[model samples]
Target: MNPASPLDNVRIVLSHTSHPGNIGATARAMKTMGLSRLYLVNPKSFPDSEADARASNARDILESACVCTSLEEAMGDTFLAAALTARSRDLSHPTRNARQAAGELIRYAHHHPVALLFGRESAGLTSAEISHCQLTVQIPANSAYSSLNLAAAVQIMAYELRMVLEEGVVADEPDPQLPEPASLQEIEGLHHHLEQVMVQSGFLDPTQPKRLMRRMRRLFARTRLEKEEVNILRGLLTAVNPHKPT
Candidate 1:
């Protein structure tokens, strides 16, 4: 792996993971694929003996893993995040197979930080959790018995990403003249600002808020907003409602 490989900018995020052993196994899996960044969101257990034992030689990855209270915090700095899900969703982001998504993620990972999200061992990622991500990825499997272990899923995705890197296949370099992509934190802030303006302007009724914001999120998710674009939109929102803070 190159010292400054794009994999360095890609993080593997496991949310609400229940098994410490799986966490350890995931660390081992990530290390094998040259992916070192690991973020744990509301995991059931960590820094435990079981996890340490499972990690084996990859204990260093476990030691350096980041633990966060929420998925938002775990991916705040990431420019793009893709959720791994087996089930279909009503208003989901664009769906892709593991290999295709790996290629797309690697493209963005070259210019900015990106993340891959995995959910709980049993239920997988919630709709709300999936909504937080900009893209959804599914691993093709036998329809009859497609269930996969948490660590197994991570390993599959990691391997695909590694393949993309090793093959020297990546998107063209980003134009330096354009502004950087918007980080998750900035996008969330824009969402909040937009909502505030909508509420104050009586455009979004707070009493019966339904899928309006969810649709808005989906719309923006498709756009892959840049930092400057986000700022411009927020500025417009502020203009619409001067009393509201940007």
Candidate 2:
């Protein structure tokens, strides 16, 4: 049997959303990021034509969305819940940047369900609603004018969640078919060979080497030269000065 996707364990909750179109757009955003679980807490409008029109290809997400009467009901069975808010309150949970908070949420979602809660469009989450979350995430934006539309906020959070999950998976599952990178020994050989050619060619001064080799090493490191690339570079260096030991 196919293992369940980590995304299945994530729920995007919108509380007291005013516009049905924003819900539809949010669904589209979530669907683009491979998130399908959606919960609406006392939305002003659902099953509205504007929502259906905006959902477009992501109508499935909206069609299956769970509508609840309250935020508590929407957060049911979630092991971790993060509230997205721009406001600062005395009693609110300590806030984290979106990416940092998403990483924590991704880790929790590995073992249990997690929820990302967003508040109303006009006035974000109430203090009472914010208290229900274990963490509060604030998207870093220009503080002078940092108000984001309901759908835009949802898109940013959904994108962050998808990125964290995808990044973790990529780290854990390297492609077996891809060639291994050039080893330190091979890279060193290439560097030494290039230095010999450069010295012979008079482009580099071996007598007074000042950060030249170090800069070259940094350049190669940035390239992440593959084994084949190193071999090609060695051949090119040999061509430059065949008399020098390659």
What are the per-model C-alpha RMSD values against the true structure?
A: 1.9, 19.5
Per-residue lDDT, model 2, residue 123, is 94
Model 2, span 1-246: residue lDDT tens: 025666788899999999999999999999998889999999998989999998889999998999999865777567667889986665446678888988877765655678899998999988667655666889999989999988898888888888886676434343566554554456667878887887888888988754576566545645555779889888888777947555
Candidate 1 similarity to native, TM-score: 0.94
Residue-wise lDDT of candidate 1 within 1-246, one digit each (tens)?
887888999999999999999999999999999999999998998888998998889999999999999988899999999999996689888899999999999988887889999999999998888878899999998899889999999999999999997787774576677668899999999999988888888899998765888888888999999999999999898788957555
In angstroms, give how far residue 84 of model 2 lies from its true place: 0.6
Give candidate 1 misplaced runs (Cα > 4 Å): 171-179, 242-246
For all candidates in order, the CA lDDT equals: 0.90, 0.79
- Candidate 1 backbone clash number: 0
Clashing residue pairs, backbone N/CA/C < 3 A, model 1: none
